[model samples]
Target chain A: MKVNEVPQDGNNFKGSDKVKKLVYAVDKDGKYTGVNTKGWEAESFATQQAWAAVEEDLKETEQQVKEGVLSPIAYFMQKCLMDLPLLAKHVGKWQWQVKRHMKPLVFNGLPAKTLQKYADAFEVSVEELKSFGK
Target chain B: MNSTNYQHCQHAHCESGVTSNLLKYAGMDISEPLAFGIGAGIFFGHLPFVKVSGTPGTTFRTWPGTIFKQVTKTLGVKVHTQSFKSVDKAMQALDDVLATGKPVGMLSSVYYLPYLPDAFRFHFNSHNLIAYGKQNGEYLISDPVMEEVSTIKPEDLIKARFAKGFPEPKGFMYYVNEVPPTVDFEYAIKKGIKKTCFMILSPPIPWFGNNAIFLLAKKVKDYPKKLTPRKAALYLGNIIRMQEEIGTGGAGFRFLYAAFLQEAADILQKQELREFAEELTQIGDNWRNFAYSAARLMKDRKSDLVSFDELSDMLYNIGTEEKQFFERLKQVKW
Candidate 1:
C-alpha cells in the first residue's frame, strides 16, 4: 500500500483551527520521519463525516427531549454514549433503578437524593438534569 | 524546574510518542516505533461485552499505560507512577514531581481538553499527554498527537484527569525516577518482536488477536438485520471513527508497526526482518483499503452504496493476511 502523503496545498483542511496529524514520510535516504499533517484528503473527509453523524445524533436527542418523547436521563445517556449498565456502575445504582428513572413520570417523582445521584453520574447538577434542553 | 530541555516530536501514536519523548528527555534516544515495539504496543481486540458509546469496543492497541510501563521496565528505567482518588491530591502530587525538574505523563479525557478541535473531542478518557510544568495558572502540555505544544487550564486538566466513565483515568500520572547509561537494544528488540507475535497469534478467545478481525466483520455484516437502519449506520460510523479518527497513525497502527519493523531490521542488521517489514507495510495498505470502503458505506447511507457483506469480506481478508504475517513473525530466529 502506498503511504498517503500530505497534500502540498493547505486548503485541504476545512476547519479554521489548523488540525495537524502525524504521517510517516520518507526522506531522500529512505528513512521514515514522522511529519505533521498539512492535510490528507481521505482522512479529513472521513473525520468530518463521522463528526457530522455525531452532531446529527445530538440534535435528534435534543429534539426528542423537547417533545417530551424521551426523559432527560435517556437524552444524556445517549449524548454521553453510555448504556444503562455503565451509567449504573458510575452512579452506584442498580440497573433496574436506572431503567425506572428513564421514564419521565418516574423521573419527575424522584426526590432530591435520587436526582442528585443521577446528576452526579452525568456530571450535571440536579437542576440541569431536571430541566435539560428546556 | 522548567521544561526547557524537553523536546517534542510528532509521532504516529500517542503513548509511543510520549514514551519516546520522555526517554529522549532523560538523555536516551529511542525512536517512537522502537519504543512502541519494545513496549509491545501492537494489539487487536473486539470485545462485544465491553461498550464504548453504545457500540462494541474495538481497540487496535494495548490498554493505556501498558507501552510506557513495558518499555521503561525492559530498558531498566526506574519510574514512579500513581493514581489518586482526590483531584486536590492528584494536582498536588503532579506539582511535587514537576518541582524536581521531571516531566509528568498523564492520562486525560479528550472531551475536556480545550486545545483539540471540537470534531475530535469525544468522551475518550485514555488520551495521554505530558505535563512538563505550570506556567501562571495553566499546565504546559506536550500532547504528541498535536503538532505544537499546548497548555491546559488547571481546573480543566483536573476535570479531564478525573473524567467519569469506564477506564476512568482517576488522575493517573507517571515520571521517570532514574535511567541507565545505555540500553541493550538488540535484546529489547527481539523480546518485543516475540511478545507482539505471541499476542497477535495466541489469544484463545474469538474476541481477541486475529480472531477479533473476523469477529468484528461478522458483527458488522449482521448490523443491518439486528439493528434499526439509523442505529446500524451509527454503529458503522463509530467503527470507522475508531479506526481512522483517534490517532492510530492510520490503518489502525499497522503502518506504525511496519515502520517499527523497518527500524528494527536496520538496528539488528537482519535482512529477514527488512523483508518482513515490507510485508507488514503491504498488510497496512490492506487495512487502509478496508477503512476506505467502510467510510464510503458510512458516508452514503443509501442501501446500494456498499453492501455489508462486501465490507465484511474485506475485513476477513485482512484477518487472513495478518494471521499469516504474525505466524511467520513468530518463527523468525532473531
Candidate 2:
C-alpha cells in the first residue's frame, strides 16, 4: 500500500488513538517506508468480535451459575479468560478434578486450602471467591 | 538503569523492533527489517488442531524468541539469555542488568501490561519489551509497538511474565553483550532467505506451511455448512485477528519481508530481489484484501456479504502464489 493510501479508518480502539502501528507502506518514491496507523477498520472489527464472543460466553456461564446448575468456580474460570484445562494447570489440579469442582455441591464443600489455591490462581482473595455472586 | 543512554526504535512488529533497538544499544546499527530478515522472521502456519485463545492457531512469523536468537547468531553477536523459576529472582536480575547500563528484553503477556491500550491487551505471552531503568518503583519499558517509551509496575510485570497459559513466558530474558564490528550482508541475507523458503515449503504436515493455507481455505469454505453462523463467524474472526491484529507488519509479515527484500536488494545490488519485493508486496495486498472481505463477512450475516467460497478462493490463491514465490526465492543466486 502507498503511504497516502495507508488505512487510517480508525475504529473504536481503546489504546489505539495514543499508539498507532508503524505499518510499512510504499512511499511517494515507490520505496518501502514505515508509516504509523491509528487503526484499521478490518482489524478492529475482528478484535471486537473476539471480545464480544468472550463476553457472550461469560454471560451464559453467569446464567448457569445463577440457575444453580454450575458452581462459582465455573463462572470465575471463564471470567479470567480460562477454561477448565488452563485453570487446572494454574491451580495444579487434574482436569477431572477441576471439572468436578464446577459442581456447586463439590465447590461449596471444598476445604479452605483448596479454595485458597483457586483464589490464588484467579488472582482473587479467598473471601472474594467465597462471596462470589452474593 | 540509564534510560538516556539508549534509543528505542519503533517498528512494525514487536520482536524485530526490540531486536533492532537492542542491537542499536550495543552500537550495532541494524534496521528492524534487517534484523527481521536476517532472523528469518517471516513465516506462515495455520494449525487447526492447535488452539490459541480458544481459536485454531495461526502464526504469521516464527515463534517468539527465535528472531532475537537467529538474528544475533547470524550477526555473530554474543548475548546472554536466561529464564527463571522464581519471580523475585527474575525481577532482581532485571534491575541488576539495568544497573549495568544494559537494557533487558523479556517476554510478557499483553493482558497484564497496563500501559497498552485496553483494546490490545490479550493473554498473549510472547510480547517483547525492554526495561531500561527503574524510576519511582516503575520499570521503564520500551515496548516496540508503542509510540513512546512506557513504564510498568513491578507487580504488574510479575503478573505479565508469569501469566499462566500455553507456552508460558517463564520469565525469559535476553540482552546483547557484544556485536561483531563487521557482518557479511550477502551470506546473512542469503541464509535468511534460504531458511525462510525451506520453512514455508518444506513442512511435511498439512496443518503447517503452504499446505496449512490450503487446509485453512478448505475449512473456511466448510465453516458455514458445518457450523452455526455465529460459530463460523467466530472462527473466521480468529483467522482475521491472526492475520491483521497484533501486528505481523501487515498482511502476515508479507509487507515486512518485502521491505526486507527491498533493503537486501539495495545492500547486495540484486535487481532480481527488487522484483521479488514488488511481487511479495502485491501478494501482501491480496492477503489484506482477504482480511478486509473476511472481516466484512464476519460483521454481517447476510447473503450479500462475501461468501465463504469467495474467501476460501482468495486464501487458496494466496497459498498458490506464496508456494511459487518461495520456490523462486529459494533459487536466488548469491
lDDT of 2 by residue, A1-134 (tens): 77887888776556567778888988877799999887788888888888888899889988888888888898889887887777888899999999999988898899999999999888899898877765
- Model 2, B1-334: lDDT tens digits are 4657888778888899999999999988889998899999988888887777677888889888889988888878999999999998998898898998899999988889998888777778899999998989898999998889998889999999988887799999999999888877778888888888988899998977788899899999999899899988888888788877777778888999999999999999999999999999999999999999998898788767689999999999999999999999998878
Give model 2's clash tally: 1
Candidate 1 per-residue lDDT over residues A1-134, each given as its tens digit: 34345343344333414566776644555555666665544455555665566668778978877887767998887676566776787678888988888778888898898888788767788888999967
TM-score top scorer: 2
Best by DockQ: 2
List where candidate 2 sits over 4 angstroms from the true fold.
none
lDDT of 1 at B309: 90
Model 1 chain B poorest 10 in a row by lDDT: B236-245
